[model samples]
Target: MPQLTLYGYYKSSCTTRLRIALALKKIEYTTVFIDFFNKEHRGAAYAAINPNMSLPTLAADEGDGQGPVYITQSVAALEYLEEAFPDNGVHLLPNNAADRARVRSLVEVVVADLQPRQAAQTLEKLGNDFNANQDQKVKWAYDWCIKELQAYETLVTATGLAGKYSVGDTLTLADVCLVPGIQNAVERWGVDLDKDFPALAKIYENLKAVPEVQGAHWSQQPDAPKE
Candidate 1:
């Protein structure tokens, strides 16, 4: 068994993705909540752990003489966990190289292209630096997120890669990335997934039905605000 510790905030989409991956992998982990609202992630202590001071920093014990390995960035952490615990948990990537590439391409559409543009940091910066109001911020987030989903919908339809989940029947890394992106689009930006993106709406519905995915939901996380 690997000793794993995950440091993250509840509402962060990146952190939520890691949570979904961990739950799906059936990996036992200790979670340390970093309160982003209070700027806890930017403090000196967290800075020492992750120079990037990003949410969802993962620390893992490899059982080698190298001691614990600390990883930052959501995608890198997920890939590391997949490689380290390949046999024990759900396979996140496909066996075929071409299929793996396709899966990664889908993952990138969310992780690299969509999520970053809608990140809290980016939105906050837009407000502070560009003097964007709340309505403007919402519009900016909604426009970019919807634009990306439009492209994603087209890609999935063109490639016929989606099944019960993205990129096939098995829940790959693409699903891990997709769910949280859609959640952010719906919850934060108030974009109607069902009305705007039917393909993604279907994928989101299927993903929500999975127990592990449900377990990893932002609303169910330890640090999520009580309603």
Candidate 2:
């Protein structure tokens, strides 16, 4: 394995997810910060790395004759890491196909369903298209996020997948997706996790104590905004 490089913004929830995955996998890597506020992701240099102009692009050295492999999108990067580093001892997906499907579904609840709607771009578009004020835009995003969080809580309980983690006893991609969304809800949108979503709050509390999760927290990132 050659050196790994991660390109992302510290404040992005998607980027935070990849950071947690890398930490859990114990992969040593370097970071190239893309300043989100300054539109650094749109620059020609980063555009060459990820044509989509997305955050959390990964470059992995394939060693030997193979050159560096570039992966974009947080979920895709995570799946790539799981497949490329299978023997590294950290598995993000379960071996059981059914369990894996369940985990993926939970992950989608956050990644596809929740995260996109709450993204800055989406919210900005919503505000412009609807002529909504800042408060209205925030309320709109918060409402949808709360709805999804409630759905996630129900899914965990109904499926009996609630254990020490999101889907089971061990950590999975679902937990990776869950933690950051919860963090954004609480810190960014002022959602009350403990009072409103106790199940997710419990899971969030437990996961926050984990060293990898704690280390990957947005506040701990080098490019996080200072007080």
Candidate 3:
């Protein structure tokens, strides 16, 4: 078994994806909190660990006389976890090929389509180069998030694959990816999930009840602010 260390920030949705996957798989790991607000990710030390300077970098040590394996990108880490420890806990990917593709489609809607647009670095550049104000940046992220989520909702309904979770009855990587994005959309962007996306709203509600999902929520992270 490889010893794992996850480097992430509390509020980062991308980080939340890995957190959920880790919790679901019953994987034990150490968390090295990266303070995104203080520009810790941009420092030289973290940059060496992850050249992309992004949150949720997974470091794995097999203790088999080999160097540690570092995985950046949230989707990649989720896939790695699924493959490396397929029997650790519940299987995130489906048994069939088509169902696996469906799961990946939903995951991509949040990870690839929407998340990058709302990333802190992108928003910072929006303010620096494009002169976007704080409100404008929030709106910018909100619009993209809503659009992607609407597409996700449509896919779920159109394909008729959604059940209690994102794909059928099993909690796949799609649900892991969706929870954090939905959190940002509703909490930060004030998206009326009930009104705007009913299918997603219901699915989000069901996912909220999941123990692993709840544990991996931003509010549950160690670095989260006290209320």
TM-score of each: 0.96, 0.95, 0.98
Winner on TM-score between 1 and 3 is: 3
Candidates in order have lDDT scores of 0.89, 0.89, 0.91
Candidate 1 ranges beyond 4 A from true positions:
none
Greater TM-score among 1 and 2 belongs to 1
Candidate 1 steric clashes:
0
- Candidate 3 local lDDT, 1-227, one digit each (tens): 88999999999999999998998899999999999999999999999989999898999999988877999888888999988998998999999999999999888888889888888888999999999999999999999988999999999999898798889989999999899899988888888999999999889989989999889888888899999
Q: Per-residue lDDT of 30-127 in model 1, one digit per residue for the tens?
A: 99999999999999999998998888899998788788788988999999988889885799999999999998998999988999898888989999
In candidate 3, residue 103 scores what lDDT?
Answer: 93
lDDT winner: 3
What candidate 3 gets wrong by more than 4 Å, as runs, is: none
Alpha-carbon RMSD, candidate 2: 1.4
Error of 3 at 110 (Å): 0.7
Clashes of 2: 0
94-212 in candidate 2: lDDT tens per residue? 99999999999999999989999889888888778988888988897899889999999999988899998888789999999898999888888889998998888889889999999
